[model samples]
Target: MRIIIAGAGDVGFHLAKLLAYEAHDINIIDMDDDRLQYISNHLDVHTTKGNSTSYRVLEEAQISKADLLIAVTESETTNISTSIIGKHLGAKKTIARVSNTEYIQRKDILDLKDIGIDEVISPESLAAKEIKRLLKESALTDTFDFEKGVLSLVGISIDEESELKDKTLVETAYLNPEYSFITVAILRGEETIIPHGDNKFMLNDHAYFICQPNGVERVLDLAGKQRESIKNLMILGGSKIGIQAARQLSKKYNIKLIEQDRDKCFELADTLPNTMIINGDGRDVELLKEEGIDDMDAFIAVTGNSETNMISSLVAKNHNVPKTISLVENMDYIHLSQNIGVDTMINKKLIAASFIFRYIRKGQVLNLTTIHGVDAEIVEFEVKEGSKILDAELRNLDFPQSALIGGVIRGGKGITARGNFMFEPKDRVVVLSKPECIRKVESYFK
Candidate 1:
């Protein structure tokens, strides 16, 4: 595929890196020569130094023959303009990264698609949704429901108390006697492992699973965690993510929002009537304690500063908060979340990049999502007629060993799939594939 990404920022860089794994012809445009140079040196992508909004730069990047154009610059105006102009210049599809929720909320009335932008993504909104998902269960490091509830992908950190700790998948197979769940990948330190029967569940390993909706409790049990309800919540930072998260989560939980800016706190009070807005420095341990931090069920730190967010979350952990979620913008710090005791460290750029990547993906892909800090993607694919996947039993299909089929939604019901299972046309299959073999796995469904 020929693709053009109009930014060298976090989202653009991550998207380009992901596309490089598929061996796509990628062209990146940005004015920052240093960022472009960094990406060019590490990734197999072409870089051009210029303004994405400039028609000359778009033409120079061969936008007319591009299969996809993604505008993700820091400026929302630039992103919208570039997407529209690129689409007019003959790019097959265009996506614009936006910061305003109104653009997405009112897209139906605005008809952005008719104006050439095929899709609009909001990092703040995406990050807010991620925070809400993480709060579903205090113990889960990460969780996402697929197809509205047919299947779920859950991640947990293995500790000394975990029954499966130090045991191989073969030994733990009895825990899932109903054949309802499967381990997809393990994130150990900086390495990502697509586990097999012999792969042992080591201490501190971040294990990921895919199971039917009915199997979530069992998956949690296997990870040595019990389900817990979250009733009280605290949000630090008055950034867009914090505000949006407060708005979304306030409907379900009692919320206390803290912002250092007095003016922002007043604005939040007016905007979120049900939420208690306090004007104070969230980083001040005394201030947090004064606000009843010890009584809170969950603590979320989403300040603009990654270091501050991590520190606040750690402080909350020290206070015995059951769930602590911190937002870390630095991609390098993602792997250190569990090791440092933060339940989940989120990167909005990565979440947006993954969503956009799914949008531009080829074939019968129904949905595609990536776990925070994990080097694999969980994709839902439709089995097309006459596809190679339906020709034989799963064990004999020679499916990429790095990819695992977790579950299948067939005949309006979801089932945990096994090696003896045979696929049928129109079945929606969920799979976890590492970057190295993503394209190879997609080929089987084509």
Candidate 2:
């Protein structure tokens, strides 16, 4: 795809990096020469050192012939205006990254789509929604639902107590004889492994499983984790993500929010009537104790500083908080979350990029998502009529070694894909694939 991206900031840079892997014709525009230079030096993309809102700059980037134009500049106004102008300049689709929650919640009133913007993404809102989902399933490191709640992909770490820790994939088959769930991928240290029959689970390995709705608890038990219900949440940072999470989860859980800035704390108190807003430093261990960190079922740190978020989450974990989620903007730090013992780590840029990449995928893919720090993707594809996938059992197919068919949803029933299982036409197949093997995996559905 011939894609033009406005801004060379984190979101735009990350999106460009993802699309560049697919060999897309990417053109990035930015006002800062240094940012543009960084992108050009690191990525195989055309960089234009100019404001994206300028028609002359857009023309220079060949926006008229672009398949998609993404506006993710820091300024919300700039992003919106660039998307609108790019759409008018003949881009087929335009996406604007917005910060204002009102622009997303009140979309019907604003109707930016009618004016040419095709989509509006709010990173903060997306992060908050992710936080809410993580809290709901406190035991799992990651969770993603496919086809509503029919099937889900969950990640859990293997510890010394895990029954499957030293067992190979085939040896653990007896644990779930009903075929309710399947382990798709394993993250050991920094390596992402698409598991096979001989692959044995090890300590500290992050195992990802695809299972039916009722199989969640079974998977948790196999990983030596018990399902915990979270009713008390303490959020550090009054940023958009923290405030949004508090607003959404206040009714369901007891929420206490701490903000370093006194003015922001008062603003949060005004907006979030149900949440207790405290004016104190989240990094202060004494203040956290005084505010009852130990009593919190889940502690979430969404502070702007990555170090602060990480340190505070560690403190919560030290205090025996069952669930600790930290928002780390630096993508490099995400891989350390599981290694350092944090429950979950989130990056708004990565979340937003993955959400947008779903629209770029080809074939019959119904849904697609990338794990927090893992180098693989969970993609759902529909088995089409007369496709080769439906002709034989999974074991007989020439499937990619770097990918695995985790589960299949047939006739609205979720089934864990086994070696003897045969695909049916119209069945939804969820496959976990590495970046290098995604194209090979997608070819079968095509």
CA lDDT, every model vs. true structure: 0.90, 0.88
Question: Against the correct fold, how does model 1 do in TM-score?
Answer: 0.95
Q: Candidate 2 lDDT, tens digit per residue, 1-446?
A: 89998988888888898788777899999999888889989999999889899999999999999999999898999999999899999999999999998878997788888999998999999999989888768888889888787899999989898999899998998999778888899988778888999999998888999989878889998877888889989999999999899989998999999998988777888899999999999899999999999898899999999889999999999999989999998767877776888778899988988878886674447888888878888888988888878778899998999899989888888888778988888899999988767777877987
Candidate 1 per-residue lDDT, tens place, 175-252, comes to 888877888999999899989999999998889988787688887877778887899999999899999999999989
Give TM-scores for every candidate, taking all chains together and pairing residue i with residue i: 0.95, 0.94
| Candidate 1 error regions (>4 Å) | none
Measured on C-alpha atoms, candidate 1 has an lDDT of 0.90
Overlapping backbone residue pairs in candidate 2 total 0
Pairs in steric clash, model 1:
none
Model 2's alpha-carbon lDDT is 0.88
Which consecutive 10 residues in model 1 have the weakest lDDT in total? 355-364
lDDT of 2 at 18: 78
